[model samples]
Target: MTQTPSSSGREGGRSLKTRVKTARKRSLSSTLWLARQLNDPYVARAKREGLRSRAAYKLIEIDERWHFLKPGQRVVDLGAAPGGWSQVAARAVGAEAGRGRVLGIDLLEMEPLPGVEFKVMDFLEAEAPRQLMEWLGGKADVVLSDMAANATGHKKTDHLRIIGLVELAADFACEVLAEGGSFLAKVIQGGTEHELLARLKREFAVVRHVKPQASRADSAELYVLATGFRGAPGA
Candidate 1:
């Protein structure tokens, strides 16, 4: 009797071959993307340190400069697919932080990670924040959203979509953040809506936008950071 290849094994091999062929078909662009990934110090460092994604470095760098995360703080991460930012928050808050927690939510499926809670749901839905608060048991110390809408190749439309998402995230943050808490959300380069900025300025003691070094230079995405929440409109 001869051993035979399993059906799963055969299918896996076929899939691998298809991927190789696809890579070959787009060799130029694929090569550039691969080269950039290979040469990225953050990529190398993430692999060496066993982090989930290179995007982790963005949060790490931001925290390093701003000192937003603390040992026993509660955090909420929106658009946390691939678990990079969640991983960083978990480590910073520690397992025994005592009521300190991190909640990560995304529309896409994500792999399970220890020390952080994850939900597969869209934050834009009205019930999502209520569910998250139930899990958190209280208001968060920081709410961070890196959500970006899929670009449609129309610059104005894309910018407007991103701003809409940012505005929603800000509103959600104002509802869930404790007094003196912080909110950070990704925005586009054309500047945020005047109404939104005005609201932030009135509610927070400090509000500013920053473009992290980890962000691509040509990218229009920036981050709006607001601190010292003064309670939502009616509180």
Candidate 2:
């Protein structure tokens, strides 16, 4: 089991270690979840690497393979809870050098990060894209979305929910991406909607679907990487 450096109990008003100890003495589910977290190699690696969440490595691995991120680029991160992907993006785009910027948004509140600007709001609302555009200050070089709808356990329904999120993210990307910009978003294994894929094919020079190694084998999630954007109709 791996343990990271932890701040004092007073920091968050109560210690997670104490809560975990109490939960271990009571609930089976809590114990199992904690055990999994402790044993997860990515979790341990993230702690050692100073990453906010294990999910950061997934994006890093994907970008390593695809070579999408570039220095001096502007990026938009959707569903950026816990600031993991934002951290990775900030580093890749050279935020420290003042040549890059990242704007992130999510429905859940995120802890502060050095280079990320995050907002808490439901992205499905109409005004969300407007706000993202305003923050971006112009078109973005890349739009990345790791958004997933809360699962309802019905396989078909859950698939639709995730696809909906992907579609919305794609639509917003089309609106704000500069020519030759890229869009990366999560989708299910069953594949994307035909209409959506058709649209992407028409708009992007290359549209490839990939499943990163860091994504769990049993999970249905995959990512769609679309590059070389063509301006949308009437844009």
TM-score top scorer: 2
Candidate 2 structure, TM-score to reference: 0.84
Tens-place lDDT digits, model 2, residues 1-235: 1232232324557534423453536687767678667656677678978899887877887798888999989998988988889999999999756789988888788988877788887667887767777887878899999888898989999988888888889988988898899999888876546677888899899998888766766677888899999976787
Off by over 4 Å in 2: 1-31
Q: Which ten residues in a row have the lowest lDDT in candidate 2?
A: 1-10
C-alpha lDDT of residue 147 in model 1: 84
Q: Which residue pairs show backbone clashes in model 1? A: none
Query: Per-candidate TM vs. native?
Result: 0.82, 0.84
